[model samples]
Target: MTEHTGSYYAATVNKATDYPPLIGDQSADVCVIGAGFTGISTALHLAERGYDVQVVEANRVGWGASGRNGGQLIGGISGEQKVANHHKRDVEDLFGELRWAGHAIVRERIQTYAIDCDLKYGYLDVAIKKRHLREFEADCRRLEKSGFPHEFRMLSKSETSETIGTDAYLGALLNMGNGHLHPLNLCVGEARAAESLGASIYEQSPVLDIEKGHRAKVVTERGSVTADFVVIAGNAYHALERQLRGIMFPVKSFIIATEPLPENVVAQINPRDLAVCDPNFLLQYFRLSADKRLLFGARFNYFGEDPAVIRKSHRKKMARIYPQLADARIDYAWGGTIGVPINRVPQLGRISPNVFYCQGYSGHGVNVTHLAGQIMADVVAGTAERFDLFASVKPLVMPGAHLLWKPMVALGILYYQVKDRL
Candidate 1:
């Protein structure tokens, strides 16, 4: 059975899951093939609406990207513009509430289910270049025009340094609507909530095939699920379906956690406890963990999981921003894969009449996955307005991209690294 990666989130999980693997034939109103955020979120949504849901997983809950991400609750879909252009609709009319719809679902679940995942408001979109600040000006205007209730403002260079204790960025845009949380705990908590509502979850049962028909049969190693509908929520980790292959590239990202800092150190850096991300294709993001450790992540060319290697590269980058952390002891380091579509849009469509699939959130999985779950439930219930909006845009497929993903991703990262410098 596949286990959760050696991530800080995993080590500090509220509770480890030991769900039984699939064993025999089963039936349900819907069978979701994944236990990550998308699957659990969908299952929880369906259970709330009185659907008999069965979820099959290849590993423990939140083991994939859903559990091992940067945990940034960033607002907005990845590629909303492309969707708007393709449909010839105004961007705001196409996606205003839809952009932050996932954030609303997350907040509601945390409160309704009493989930304790170190939820906090405040985020920074730091600018590494002057052009980025101009972009922020436009974003701020849009927020103001929309009458965004949350506190948001653009910070000057000096103000940005004062806020994050880093002069690496020229400026920043602070958005309270966007924040961070403990993703693994949130995912596990949601799964537990689904269980309480009568949804069945089978972990460590990797799906082998899907026999599409009136009622699709999701085949696993030891058992099979024949449901009226099947939902494929496995993003980057799943490779069983041929239809999904080559549609998106799997990009690897790594993160390192520092030991809990001294109170003075914490106050000196990130006193407000805000998540920080720079505006770059090959960007860097960091936030203080609930225990006060700095969790930093970035995309590099390395594909291996050796913590030592990850720490060596990330520590250097971290120190470049905060010199005081130059000697800080690194406690944990890990990596995960993200499904990045070529066009940067979230891929939501049908593999068959009753077999639905959703993937490719780029790096915005935490917030978007929750909204996607709701949309998936809506699609199952005959409401496809939101689903159709995303489904209308066909994925820009790269032939044999999956087979040669490693080299392709490496080249892409190199290209972005060059672009970021320009």
Candidate 2:
């Protein structure tokens, strides 16, 4: 099997762990499939609640999106406002409470587990158009009315340029509450935390199938895990169930890490070291690493895993934003697939009463996945209020999504690209 610790975050992981593959029949109170953030988060939550949990991963821990994400901890779920609009009630109270809950969970977990992932606070939601500025102003107003604890300010054009060293944006909404981190380390550290709490994790053990009933049995190549409930948290990399396969499209996002910049260059650009995301359907998000490298990311028409091509495409975009970085050497380039539902909301529901699944967070996986893990855990524990809020929104499944995912995703990207330009 390929080594999982080759990614940039992997190279700098706080700790290295090698767990054996599942080799025999095992049983637990819950069996989770896939060891990405969703699976690991769910397993960790259940284990913390004193449940016997066994996690089965196709690769090593954090090998999928969890290990490969941009690590921006922006709050709020995808399409939450639209979902709340459908309830015909005051969802402000419900969503307002849950909006920053994931952020709280992340901060508490980092402190409680002592996960060394270079966690920091500060982010900017930048605007490129007058409409974007208006929306950001509205967002700032809402946060102010809600008495947001963190420092949030609306930046003028000059302030925006000063903060980001880029005149590409018209203005920005800065929030000290949001931040970035080393995602893979957090995932691995959380898995370790779960392991310490008596949870069992098996790597290189892809789940072949799940036999569902009162007690679900997850069958791997070399072992089987029987549990009272089964949680499928694979997100976009999952292939175990046919029902979820065709329900969403896997869109590829790529990122490139430039060599650590000079102190003056770093000071000139991103002096505050805050994560920044543009407001566009096909967006670009970037931030500086603890080692002082500019990690830039974007979506493109490509889907292959060629690092050279990713570097070429993403470097050009990065240079467009900051021309001084045009000659910077790219140290790392990689891509990962994100499961995007048709309606842009996260998919959380049950294939069976004893089997629950949550996936398709669009690009907001980091924050939403943690909240989802909590919701999934609550669902298994017979708390369905928050679970139902998401599960009620059924996924819009395409006719041939599984068979034609590539073409479909390419078309969707093209559509979004056009929309972003307009």
Candidate 3:
């Protein structure tokens, strides 16, 4: 259960960060747990605002999904349209303003902190069926109607193949606003920025218990932190709290990074270097790393920490998309868990007035988590407009969600497989 780092992103992390574990009583305006994107982002936001903030992590910084995820910077929130349907307000007007807020934040953070995370521009939402093409068309129309600042266009079958070197997609919607980056470096760089702004961070300091009150006391094995407010940013990796444990199901997603290919192979595979994602319910997302290696990701049935099994499953899926890569050597294989709420909307609310929580971004964590951090900071400061928007939607908690996650996820995979086929 204990490993330093196995993914290619971890192997090449620009800087390694180490902080002393919590060992004595401490106090702060805010204390965040988990140390992933959500925790780091929130601490950064708070610290920048002149608030005293501290972050405690059970593992090293960016050790969870934040470091291991496919670096696709996709737009929009998952299941947002459904939530919009439930409201009387113009969903477009309300969410459109916030849709790209995370991207803007990410871009600014990279520039401000001088974080080199192999950031790139351009992405394609590819379609596997005529229905998916229709969806893409609708999305393009929406972007135009919303007066999107980015260049967005729909590609025909030939154009799609020319752009991605794959014939599996019927069509695609190209959005320059969406892009990719090295996620581990981004998270760590953001943590550095937060620290520079006076946020204290402790790694390998897992919270053992929380004593809730007007000011909560977060207890670790050897130390504790009392704070005006506590934010649980642990998401799927967290197991400390009973309320969080079984509310959201942990779904494992795997990825394989192939060894850098020949220049011609790279040219033939992804000429424009756009990140590509398929429209299947059980999705496949791929993009080129800065060093010109293909990073392919897919959802599979196997669970546990066996990298060999993960590599085999993901490699087969990669070959299916581009048979020319049947012999591509996989350089790294790893898996991470994503918190999937029953409604597919990210859960944001207060367990107590002084104890706030945010989790369950499904597979949309990269973009949405930043937005969530901002919303969380806003909530801590008494601005609840955006927070209420999400909190108003109740999470669908399944019985024994933590214990039955494996079987439930298998069922979901089968269901999405059928849906994708239809």
| lDDT top scorer | 1
| Candidate 2 lDDT by residue in tens digits, 87-184 | 76565676876888888888888999999999989999999889999999988998998899999999999999999898989999999989999999
Over the stretch 1-422, how does candidate 1's per-residue lDDT look in tens digits? Answer: 67888999999999988889999999999999999999999999999999999999999999999888888999899999999999999999878888899999999999999998999999999999999999999999999999898999999999999998888999999999999999999999999999999999999999999999999999998999999999999999889888899999999899999999999999889999999998788889999999999999998998889999999999999999999999999999999989999999899999999999999999999999999999999999999999999999999999999789989999999899999998
Task: Kindly provide the TM-score of model 3 when superposed on the true structure, using C-alpha atoms.
Answer: 0.98
* Higher-TM-score candidate of 1 and 2: 1
Q: What's the C-alpha lDDT at position 134 in model 1?
A: 95
Q: For model 2, where is the 10-residue window of minimal lDDT?
A: 1-10
What are the per-residue Cα lDDT tens digits for candidate 3 across 6-73?
Answer: 89898889988888889999999999997899999999989988889999998888999999999999
* Per-residue error (Å), model 2, residue 304: 0.5
For candidate 3, the per-residue lDDT at 107 reads 96
Kindly report which residue stretches of model 3 are placed more than 4 angstroms away from their true locations once superposed: 1-3
After superposition, the stretches of candidate 1 with alpha carbons farther than 4 Å from their true spots are none
- What residue pairs clash in candidate 2, if any at all? none
Q: Which stretches of candidate 2 lie over 4 Å from their true place?
A: none
Superposed Cα deviation of residue 8, candidate 3 (Å):
0.9
User: After superposition on all CA atoms, how large is the RMSD of candidate 3?
Assistant: 1.2
